[model samples]
Target chain A: MNRFAGPDGNIETEIQKSLLNIDGGIMNILSTVIRKTILTVSFVSLLPVITLTVSAQELNALVWCDHADDKLLKPFEEMHNVKVNIKTYEGTGAALSIIEQSAPGDWDVLVVDAPDAPTVAGLGLLEPYDASTLPMSDLFPQLTEAPFNYLDGKRYTIPEKFGYYGVAYNKDKVDPEDMKTAEVMWNPKYKGRVAVYDYYFPTMQLVAISMGISPDNITADDLEEIRKRLLEMKPNIKMVGDIVSVQNALVNGDVDIILNAAEFVVSGLMPTLPSLDWNIFEEGGLMWIQGLSIFKDSKNKDLALEFVKYVVSPEGQSRLATSECYWAMPANSTTQLSDAEREILRWDEQPGYLARSVPSTISRPEIDAKMLDIWTEFLQK
Target chain B: MAKESKSLKPLHIDYTRWAFHPALWFTICFFIFPLAVMLAISFWQRVYGRLSATWDVANYVKFFGSDYLIDSLTNSIEVTVLTTVISILLAYPLAYILAFKVPKRIQGILLLVAVMPFWTAYVVRSYSWLLVISENGILNVFLKGIGLIDQPLEMAYGQGATVLGFVHFFTMLITLTIYANLVQIKSSYWKAAADLGAGPVRIFFRVTLPLSVPGIVVGAFISFVIAIGDYITPQILGGGTDILIPQAIMLQISRAANFPMASVMAVTLMAVVVLVYAISAKHMKMERV
Candidate 1:
């Protein structure tokens, strides 16, 4: 007999009679289903907590995608005997918003744009640490004592990973010589074959450099000229996108050049596609630096500091520089990288690049707002 | 007589009246509450990355004043409308065949095949489309191999590609809705029309098409609502050549943490959807489908 058959062995009639009995039939089935759904949803939502319960301690870090690599995290996780829960975000605005939405002590560690460290510290989101404890001399000299990392003579954050905002392009498609200068952004020869990286800070600064204006000296009046120059390049531009999209454009041969991108965008792919290359402009390059800091309200300050130290160590720095997501230069000059890896990162040229480039500006609110407005206009154009 | 008739009715309360309470509460909690919050936030100000409760309309004013900001809405409408029209045109015929010509046993399999695209991740689906239509993509390679042109056609990173992606997804949605409505339609109506001296074409024109209007409207309306608000499809497939309203809203939140501006854009998008709903409400028979 079928399992669902009734006592009399008449399946159709029994099922009909049962359904007719509303008290024991449809309503019961519906309520059971609803109960099961709620139970399932509740269980699924509690999964992270369940995992955390098995671990001795948990360190929650808000970081960039590079820090989420298992290779970079697993060693530290094993050493500290703690579970690391990482939530990755892009852009300072988004990171700040995440911190604002979170309760105190919810996040123990933070990785942010090095330039925004002071702004964050001002908001009382960061905890200061003693610089003497760190390998201060081992770090790239330019990154060690920037004004952004300090507030009222106290160090709030330390530089972790650094790279340049330059051009990544197909060497076969565009002249390597032309890539050396900022004016290649609007070079008529490569018109309709350029994809600009969709970050307002670096792209505007790069354009300002092309027009002989430094990023730090960008006033409200400079914006009109910048806007005109940006709009003029729209005809040459095919698309403006994030890292992945811009990378896809170069890989797929959709565009010859990716403006405001560099080794961080294409280094991972260069081994497979030899024609792909990146370089800073003759005028100047904008250096992007990421910093690591502990949250001011962190309950696990000791564990957070341990994680920070581990990230800045030679082994951690090497792992992070060649992380699965993207590759960039480590902030520590003594990081252990393979010869090929160092070559791809242009390690030998760092001193010259550092000398020629200034860290990307962290603009005041009014200037940032105006720059964003012009960027929005640029995208629409 | 009226009093006696009233007394003849059952004295027990009808419990079915409370059946819709869960749905009502769900809407109140999920929809009305969030919308209210968004409306409130739209009037606030964003100061140095934190939301300040100024209760001013500066965000809205800025949105209206900026041409580029307004362009995002226009672009969204253009893409969404094109997607809806093209989807309905493609879906109606497919739904007609599924309802009338296809065998009953195989219809289930065919419908499943049609909606199989929905099983994949939305972002993955968009990227797949990009791969198929990109410069060095299969389409160009195939065309080039056949001597179709000297230069590859620029297909990806444009409004056209965005529409293509939307049509691929939403056509299946519309097909299912229209098919549901078409199957529910009794064949007797067609036979009766035929017996009354109407030809097959005339019968379909007079009976089937008119009766299927509800399905068309409902599906088209849903396509409009979803496509207008979608961010991923356009962001990946459209290649950010032109920004959509959702992209603009994300820019505000992600780049500026300007919740007030983002909320203003959200409210505007919701208003457009509501306006479209109001226009289509008369032709809709949501429960029937």
Candidate 2:
């Protein structure tokens, strides 16, 4: 301090200090800009990844059209912030084939008819549902203990809806008194005037029931007899179709009667036609129950179970039942449905109607893989 | 003699020629690889609800064993043969008219009319025939109004309806092929034949028919292949009585989930089509020579 203490020394020391300060400031500003840029780039890159992760967490489900209402799933979706994807199938077999092909976690939840649940479960496609986890008490008592969903007391499916499958005819062309039974559909009088479903199982079952053979004990021999009956009915049949074409035929008077049709078809057509009627045969008709199932390989098991719980909930069942104009019989025993709503759904406890509504006595025959081939061959011939 | 010659140098191999070629490997990966995989799948076995790699001939054996399958194959052949013959017979006259009789100004319009159906969906065209032939259809109403019959003829879902549908759909292609050949045929050749004292039929057979053979051959081949593979038309029109190969394959895959069996049927059908095409190609070559 004594030796370098001069006017020039003071100025030099001050200039060095200022230069150091500027250098430090420039470095700090450059580093901050670089860090911000990196953070912005990283956030942009992570946008799709984050979105995919969220979406993957959502349960993916495929169901038949008109099976469930979309709004019923809003609460479940919102609760877990998970999306629910519902794809509809035209027919049970069509839905089954898709599930079979895309097996092993392809779908989380499936809406299979009760008849198909055992078959699908037998194929090792369905996972055992945890009853304790869901509100099992809210389901309809009949479905809660239905044989279709229970295999050795383990429920693979939750029964969702029940309906009757039989003849749906135009009231104008076919008198209600004359159409007391499904036998009139095959009468020679309606030759080339009637419509029937082309599917083998339903058509064959209807013919079997009409012939006084319980559909439950159908075998290959029974199929042969049924085939002969079908051949007999073929000349009188104008067209074989599903609900849409059948309804169209009924409304347009293209066909007088439709064989092996569901009551919902008649219900839907009643508003427009108002003259259409449904008939349950004396031998009884096919009582179908459709249910919900979870795939064995579902990644979002919790979400799927939660969604199933919501579907079987009283509110959800009512929503589905009201919207689809069909019965969403809960599997739970305790869930209460109002008398007005039950009346609207035509849930009268009539002994005659209930007795007639017994599920088709037709045994779910072990479908021979070769049967379709054989049938196609016979039909083609 | 001592001068070096750059023009006489041999060309070098250009290894980098395909450096920028995008479709070179893309086409192979997408088309060829999938075809190879399909071929491989056709040879695999299905056992106990699981697919195994054990190669077997069971699928092929099963396909050949079924009378339904054989019937479908036979039906496909019969339909194709009928469609080809009918299309040729109908197309030749129209082609002759367009080339030798119609004015040049109307040829474009005529050709456009022939090709107009191609713009529509094949299914729509097939189903439209239903409305034309059904009991409550327009054709029935008109026929009944004119007192042609006491009852509406059940024309839909029958062999006759199927053949008619095929003829309606495929005749246009045949006409276009024949017409293209007809336009190319020189008028000078026909005039020369006439000048040499040949009659109309003789000139047509000697020059016109022989020259139009290539077009006829091409059209017939295309029509035959298309008709053979067609399942939708036969399904819509052939009634429950008629079965086709595609339908059999569809039944196997869709209803039975027997993909191996379906693959076998598909491969067999492909083989049959290829064999038929080879025979036709040979015949065409001989005719050309």
Candidate 3:
């Protein structure tokens, strides 16, 4: 009767058995699908919470390009079991803009030009930290009492890295003797062969130093003279640009000399490009120091302070000194840099260089504006 | 049938009216609001690096008074106009071939090949150009190999290089726009001109060229607007030999946090673009093709 019958010859029984089997198979498939859908939906629903938990452990920093190095930050992240989010800005103005646009507690740390640190502190954006807590003894003595690191007799930021705004040149193309004097900036022989680093402050300061005017002593009246001196070098200046552009000019042989640049511009390239070298002029070098500070409204203040501590440590200093972005002298005197690395940074010459250099300062607002105006004229010339 | 049509008219009108709401909202939220804010900010002042709502036009006064600053505006206009003229000159012939000469079956592929470089990053393309034209770059190396010159040419950096960079990018953009306009022209128009005892050259000059004015004007306007506002191309290739308005604007914002002054420059730039639009409005057939 029924071909689907098992062993018994009952047609109704065989038919019922076959129907049950079909229903069971459909139920199994439905259960599996429902289970998978439920699991997936549950997982997706918890994603935001999971993300919140992970982000809560992150430390946000607004810094210069140097602090973005993975080699400098990875150890700190691994040690603290936290994520570090960095936003690199070109200038103090940009960093301030970022802070102004963000909500309170959004940023945990800041790295600023040392001369601007006090101004930033005056704005009530930074929290004061004890000098005793920092590794002050291990740092160069001159960096410890930096006037810009303090405001109203309280320390607001600590110097993390320091370098000079001087000269970098291709030794093969230029006479090494000519680089020792600031006169090389305006030397007619090198006309259209010099690239000036396009930073108004230190470059103007260098011009002031060449004119035998100290940067700290610069007044509003001195800008015209400084502007004149700056324009005198226009003949020699093939280009004026930022670190990367000036570096490109040098590497491409577009220019033979770079003004307002030192080891920070060419030190990293020296090992591969032995022809490149940097030195300060006899007039004196203008020192540029970058400072680290904690934000006043940081939710993760403790973690932020710990990161500062890690950055100023010897190991961190070494990594930072050889950072991918640029190589410069670390604030900490006792960095663990290799012998070859030390040679590139001119470690042994730091004492003499530091003695000759006065830290670059932020001028009064009027003077700063005047400097920018004159610098613009120099560029447009 | 008339009753049914009348009944559907109100529904159709209602649907069309509601459809524009999203675009209106977007314009208000993104364009009108920010522009209003910028206009307001232009009258403010930066007092010791802090934004002050003094509601004065001193920033504008200062910009107009400074010769160096005014030079930046002039430089921008000069560079942008030169670049736009050069780009249109280069793009038109390429677009004409694509629209009239290339076979319809492979036009799409050919157009893709023509604009393929547009897919790359702008900054990368700029730097690549620098590497090719720099003193010791590829061009010099090749010239040296061929013993064409004893010294490397001073080709990179300056207004010429800046124009070159802009032309390289905008040429492709303009070609696409011109091609679009060219293809939409009825073939019957060209055929009609030929049938009227006109030669190919005469027909092209009288009919095809005249019809392509809308595309050229539209492209030129876009090129003018973008080139004038751009900071990177001029900054990278111009080599600080001169300063453009955008670079001058950036200097204020980046170095001084002088948003009031930056806003002044931006408003001035916007005014120039609007003036250009007014000048070219007759031929800008934006809705066509």
Candidate 4:
């Protein structure tokens, strides 16, 4: 044992010191490696979640079945990587109620008819859309300066589609030449053989126009006169419903003529029922445009603005026009359409002719929200 | 010493007796409490896009004030009375045949046939009736083919159509109820009356008819209650002219967004049903005695 031991007792103490030093060094190196690895993994894991959280802002889009195209939204979603929840309401009243209830933050983008735009913008629910930020030079002059969008030199909504309400008649029952004017609808020659929209707004407005009342200065007395005229023509109406049902009734010969039907409804029925003919009234018809507006309190303001641009863009508007044969006059002037497409879209180039053909009129007083109770009372009675 | 001895003795009590008992308090909390809340809200005013806590009776006042509301209420009562009478008349014979004439093995099959329409969706059954009653439908075609009439009659939107639809849909349940009560009566009672030289009509009036009063009352009560609240058949088949209580309530809620008015109508309906149930229960008990 003495031989195996070190030469001095201090030898054991020196070896112990050496071992402790090596052990401390190894532990320090291992801790440093572990800290770096953990930091690296945590940093990598957080990138996607942080990006997603930032992109998870609220989105609002107004949708109506068979009206709003769903395909145009895909590119916007891919670019922004955010959820675009579209809320589709059935009727005009339901849509108005949605905007009234959830104003500012309720919807990010709204597709409202041109007549409703003034009322909606007047309520301060829509923000002033800065057309200068987008390619405004490419838009049509009429669309850019449309009275519906321009209020006090500030534009609130941009026109996406334009159409007209006209009379669609069954050629088998009604001669095309005989149904050229609005007065034909009121003529007693078609008693119990014609139909009109059930809503009083369109019916009353058309009646007012035929009665020679200026569309701009329609009053309560004017409305009463229109109502009386309508009641007198009640014997002519076989049935009254929306455009689709009216078209079906026309094709089936259940009704000879339908007043206030959209151009698209008549055109769509033309292929199936070859006898159907659509004619614009010479007294003037409603040249309506549906415009898109951004909600005031939208969380996804930038995304919503991008959506509006996409809708008014040549490609987006053209896509809508081609698919549904929608009477969409593209806002973008740069877009070129084929002759067939132009005919189908019903493009009206001459400003004076277009103006005289489809008269731009204010919405009826019956559509005023304050007078809804009165309207319902009259309807129920 | 007595206290020490009582402590030493073991106490025995059965804690398992309540294992099958229902929780009455739980039922009251969930079911009864919500109904009470609805009744309370019915008496209040709705303001500023929300219900106000103010107790205003204007909703009730409006319901009673309008001739429209009064007319709908009267129509509902009239329809209920007519439906009850028709159901009873149709259900009594079918119930009698099922309980007395039919064989034991075949009775189940016959009862199934009676309740077959109930197995199908009510709307689908109602719609089938619509097709049968439409202008160009089978009934008109047959009637015209047989030279009964030159033109198709307008039968779709009227009170007659609505009452017919209700009776077609509800007769099965009435038959089943009457049959159930009829089967429970012992045949020996009728046998005993017949052996005493009583005729068929006499025995029916004396024994079978009196014994079956319970089923008649229950069937009539159920038919009346259902017919009073029904609005869909009336709305679709009765056209725009028929405005029942439920339709008025629905119009107020959906078209007008007037929840207080709808609630008031609902509360009135509930009161009528409760009064009817109370009267029926009293009459049933009196007859039993």
Candidate 5:
């Protein structure tokens, strides 16, 4: 600068120095922005893996298809920061077979038939639980400390969901008044327009009710009368199906009436097909209560217990009631439901329905075997 | 000298023979071993949910004693026989057309088009048939629009519906098999028969039909075995008006957890298939090609 510039301060040199300073500042800003962008991208990419690694712990349960819905599981997942693994089964027999084939500690929870609670616990598969930890005060009162929840005087399970097995029909296609009686099942007017539920326990219980016998007191001697009635109803039925198939048959106009239908079938379809509806028959209906129990070999018992508590809570009950797989009445009386949902589920009529309904109980092995035999014969006939 | 000659036998070996025995051992370990377990279980008793190994033949006795249960066997055989005969009658002509009438250049495309329905899920295919034939289904809707009938016909969910579902699937299988056999029949054989003063009808019965007996028997035997053992078609399409043996077996396993009884039913089914195989093996050797 001394050799090329004049005393008055060389303007060219000054301008060059200012320009270089500005360029250097710009370069510094660009490097900082690039570094931050890479860091943010990397952190965002690894979040799920980090979450999974930290919450690698999972609670495994054997449940029905209703528990497969994410709306019922997501809030709990977010709260506990844990994964829930579930396997669905059709009946208690299928559930037992699955558990027998699994290794110890492979399952953390079980959702079994309420009547099967004692029998299942007797096998030493479920652990005894303290009753006071749960919000028992919020339950329907009859569900808490009920005979079905105890085994040898120890509390082992709690009712989570319950509904009645009865009939659903297209109100316009079939007379709503005729549906109140079980005798309507075999009426010639509805011939080739009826769908029977394929399940034996409840269907047989419905038949027992029609025979003036209680499902809880069914004996080997009563099976013949039930068999005759079922055979008489066979020709009137167009199909025998599970919950979904029978529901489809009714909604698609293939059948006008469904015997052994429950709220699980008609709840979801009510919005689209306003004609779909259900009611307990005057002859009688069997009430089914599904309960949740902890496994003795659960490695994640603490988390599993938390999950059970969540499942019976008001918010959780609302979610489970409207689960995507199907819907049933929540066991919690204080469950949150809109006015419309309450109307659809017939909330106001539950007291009368509950009083008239019989628990879906079964007989001892010998009598049960006889009942199944008669049921098989009825299917063939 | 005798010791030296015995020592120098050159160790003759066959590598292919070594593999054959291992494959047989593998089959025995996987298939025969499970069958043996099932046989042992059939004698056991299931009281409540517990499995008791006390040996007895009560399950087999029940199968033979109960008329309703035994009737499932008769239903299975009747349904399967009718399905096999109907499929053969339907598939043979279509197979003949494809093999002889269709040009060879377009044969591959035509075969693909023919079997296109089978490319769907097995369960979905049965449901598709149900949708087409149900009371409110496409056919009924189309017919009702044209004033063909006042009431919708009951064409779905019965023994007839089950037969229709089975025939729809098995016809593809039988057609493929018969088409293979038909193509293998040389045109020169038909020419020789024509030159021998044999009319078309005589040539058909004497030459064409007799040569294809193995194909028909093989297809029919396969159809009989599979259709008899299947549970889905009868359960879905038979409308619970009738029970098949597999449905009865499922009732035991699915709800009762009575493996002993289920195994008895399964073994009885195996015996029936074996009897059919024994009868068919006299004339049709499926492996003789």
Candidate 6:
């Protein structure tokens, strides 16, 4: 006998009897309604399990690694009776891919590159959030750039953190004076003793900046020179890597200097490795801004907006700046910091650093593809 | 009698035939369906932010046309071939030792020892290798202290590091497979060879190796497929110096959010794996195991 043979397993008992009672033509309609009702009931029964899986108070965010730190999120999570579920990605590219794969309303918050805010918003990916309650007065003057936090005169993404992409070096091995110029990047003296940041946009822009082209005004004509300059430095570069890899290169003494690193590389390590430091070259550095935005399709719009507001708040800003991923300067000017953290960020030198840096330029698709091609060639060199 | 048999068939269905249903459905749903989707998407194009359903081979053209992109596949094959060959060379001896030299009473424990490192995570194993070989790592510290060199050697980055990481993992896998093949050989075959006046070396070359081709080929083919499709080892240790096909595929998805381009590269990778399987199928009698 079949294992399922039993009174309950026999479909003919109830369903067949019901079908026999209906006329042939009417049977189809009756069966359709019955199926719909049963499906509705089954779906309703699964509601609580689904709710438990992602509770009402839970906020799902796709963001950078810094926001994943429990220390950065704990207070906010506790006070709001909510859980902040974060998926950290290294770049806006990776983050976008993650968001694309997710179901509608699956994500509540998005932390992305400040320059990408306008582009992402135009894609209808961001919710236009009111920033009236936010401590806008306490934001760093430079971080309030319209192109970054505002799109078409409306708020989309709010800058949460900002840092320079420049030279980070071990003072014991590198001459600090020589580090002041971009020329040190390709210097033979540092051959096989340098690691570079692996991102194409900022690295290419930094190269353009060195060659007297403002990042915002880089033209196709400028790329030939830029590519040549990048290739020349290949022999000197021991490795090109992301944040953690470049930091590992420096901390492990595998490289003496990171050609495109900034405070994120040395800020946390400054105390343990006091010799590690960073500086913007005379040619200027690329300013990278990270911002927070609410997803357009977020189910929890109110909660997500509040979370974004809190991230830009003074208390949240401090914790975020010192998050375990890496340390950088928080956008909120009122962030409380100890003497050591302040020293590492060089809090007093903000004006000087901002003066010598240009925020990242919004990339056009054609130009972006061209630059990526060049960068790929440089890596293979 | 035949009409009665037809009635009996309905009451006593061939349940044994239904056993293969699960595997068939699994293949259709997971493997065949996804592969079809990937293949279909490969001909689609993604222009800027827009994904067009209009079929075209621009992606495949660009993939093959770009030297930079083509180099990654070349590099992948080079690395995978070297890793598989090196793995077999190292694993065969260890497998031989375990199968022949180790006492039967303790062979299980010895085999367990061979698998001890596999218990650790694969990514962790690669990370450990990086830590051990970095310029300031123990290898350098010890070498310097022993007066081997005045300056620390660079051993932790580039293609070399990637190969070392792959070889470390694949060797263990190949060893287990080869050892299983070795022990299954009949003892009478070796006895007959010795009686025929064939020396130990001759007997090993003539009798043992010939019997073990299936295991070796199976292991090597597995190693090749896995090492070629892998993204992590090259990403973490290769230092972005050499791009592998998997990395290039991810670059499209991540950097450009270009799904069509990524799909093309993935399909290409699958084609290469299929070609490899076709070539090795003759010596790959996995059913014998």
Clashes of each: 0, 12, 0, 1, 0, 0
DockQ, every prediction: 0.49, 0.25, 0.62, 0.09, 0.42, 0.42
- Candidate 2 per-residue C-alpha lDDT over A1-381 given as tens digits, one digit per residue, 9 for 90 to 100: 545445566866665556558958655676789999999999999987888687657678988665446666776777777878888886567877787678578689998877678777887778897777766664555555767786666789987766666777777776766566767766887776676655556566677788887776667776767767666766676655446545555554557787777466665445455677676676766666778899888987778888887777766666665555333334443445677545433455323544565564323325545346545754564
Residue B115, candidate 5: how far off, in angstroms? 2.6
Please report the TM-score between candidate 3 and the true structure. 0.85
Model 6 compared with the native: what TM-score? Answer: 0.83
Worst 10 residues of 3 chain B by lDDT: B10-19
Name the lDDT value of residue B260 in candidate 5.
Answer: 95
Q: Please tell me how candidate 5 rates in CAPRI terms.
A: acceptable
- As for DockQ, the candidate ahead, 2 or 4, is 2
Give the best candidate by TM-score. 5
Tens digits of per-residue lDDT for model 6, B1-289: 9998887874567777876799988999999999999889889887666788879898889889999888888999999999999999999999999899989999999888878887988778877888888988989999999999898888988889999999988998899889989999889988999999999999999999989988899899989999999988998888878788888887777677678888988988998999999999999774443
Best by DockQ: 3
lDDT of each: 0.90, 0.71, 0.89, 0.68, 0.85, 0.85
lDDT of 4 by residue, B65-173 (tens): 8766766677777777877788788989989999989899999999889988778776666556656776656787889999998977656545677788888867777
TM-score of candidate 6's A chain against the true A chain: 0.81
Q: Please give, for residues A1-381, the per-residue lDDT of candidate 4 as tens digits.
A: 454345565666556555557958655677788999999999889977887688766467885543445566666667667767788776556887877776467778887766567777777777887767766777666665767676667788777766566677777777788787888777888886776654545556677778887655677666666666766666676555445445545654446788776565676444455676665677876666667788777877888888777766777766655444334456576666677556544554425425664435454434332223333333232
State the lDDT of candidate 5 residue by residue for A23-92, as single tens digits: 5765567678899999998999999788889999888989988999898888899999899989999778
Model 2 per-residue lDDT tens digits across residues B79-185: 78888899899988988788778899988888888888888888788767877887778888899999998876777765677889899878889888888887887
Error of 4 at A220 (Å): 5.9
Q: Please tell me which model should have the higher DockQ, number 1 or number 4.
A: 1
Per-model fnat list: 0.68, 0.34, 0.68, 0.00, 0.55, 0.57
> Which CAPRI category fits model 1?
acceptable
Task: Report how far off residue A77 is in candidate 3 (Å).
Answer: 5.4
Regions of candidate 1 where Cα sits further than 4 Å from its true position: A1-62, A73-87, A92-109, A295-310, B1-22, B47-57, B195-197, B286-289
